[model samples]
Target: MAESKTNAMRLLDKSQIPYETLNYDHEDGQIHGTAVAEKIGRPQESVFKTLVAHQSGQISQICVFVIPVAEELDLKKAAKAAGAKKIEMLPVKDLLKWTGYIRGGCSPVGMKKLYPTFIDASAEGLKIIAVSAGRIGTQMELNPQQLAEQVKAVFFPLTKEA
Candidate 1:
């Protein structure tokens, strides 16, 4: 059964954005994007992982990226997309403070603050993609464009060439 509404889900509701919840099994420790995709029974490319990153010397400017679980974030490309000199993933310890989300369960929607967010351009043609529902054992599915709009995100080539 689907669990109760998460903060992310609640916000989606408030925005009147249509989405579907997907429940999956999760282990106690960190779960990789591929494992998440498998648990949710979706193609690896259709499942995205939310990453928190920031440009050097600009810790206050947090950037969010929603990219394929199977792909690696191309720091150089992502930095360019965000108009930064360089970009690096934020430390895991600081994730909650910056984004109000944890490592494995982070979602682009309903963050502590709306920072600059980007969805991998590859998500453009895909009909739907799955992301964390702001908690473990859960995911949400919807059109990538809709997700981007809800979070005021840009579509950019932020992932390494696959």
Candidate 2:
């Protein structure tokens, strides 16, 4: 398959950030984060999914989170990290309206706006991490710290305890 370029990929290129693109079969329509991680042969902990959430009662106030595909977001922890009283996952229907990306294709980079972003603290020690390349079937692997820096994200405990 020919390589496809996405806004996230383009942004990384413009910033001169080093990243490797990984593609997997999306034709089956199984585009879940965990599936993508497994298909790419990367450890679950090293592949993250981008989630969008909103401050309770304030649809306008949004934040982005990047957590391991195998884990679930802890709303309490995420709220604390985001300095929000309460946080709720943004409805899938509104994802594109806000982040310009749909479920399973959201990327932490190149959102419609630079909303507050927080990466799971677990990613801190990782040499590299993979995130969506702003489209289904594509992912970009790069240094975790560099990914956070590029998106102005902070490391925080945002996942539920297993």
Candidate 3:
């Protein structure tokens, strides 16, 4: 059943990141990340969502953000970390093309390209965390360090009060 979803299972197999797959009835038109956390009975802080952003100016760069659902990404801090002046969230279509995942189900692993990946420093404190397995109604639990390693991510203080 888990293998039915291509994206998440692909990463699990490719990276050899041991994970437990969880499936729940995904409510139609539900608000995303938070709802998934609630369904799994985990604090929103322990569930991260992936976002894609594009930097402006001559050196345009595509970046991936992995942050807790309960926290807001500090654009300034992210820009500083990415060596950009400003960063803007990319359109959903662009996100799909770049990350190979949809808006509500993006995962840092198994992306179409290896962009600059940034994971909030808070994630480092957790022994295990959940992230989208590239689709709605599906999630995976894995060690934060292994997740970062698989994505080649840089840990930084990229989050702030929501």
Query: Which has the greatest TM-score?
Result: 2
Q: For residues 66-134, could you state the per-residue lDDT of candidate 2 as single tens digits?
A: 999999999999999999899999999999999999899999999999999999999999999999999
Q: Identify the superior model by lDDT, candidate 2 or candidate 3.
A: 2
Q: What lDDT does the true structure give each of the candidates? A: 0.91, 0.94, 0.82
For candidate 1, write residues 7-126 as lDDT tens digits. 999998998888999888776554788988888899998999999999987788899999999999999999998999999899999999998888888999999999999999999999
If the candidates were sorted by their TM-score against the true structure, best first, what order would they fall in?
A: 2, 1, 3
Error of 3 at 25 (Å): 1.8
Backbone clash total, candidate 3: 0
Instruction: Give the better candidate number (1 or 2) by lDDT.
Output: 2
Candidate 2: stretches off by over 4 Å: none
Which 10 successive residues of model 1 have the least lDDT summed? Answer: 23-32
Estimate TM-scores for all models: 0.95, 0.97, 0.90
Q: Residue 57 lDDT in model 3?
A: 52
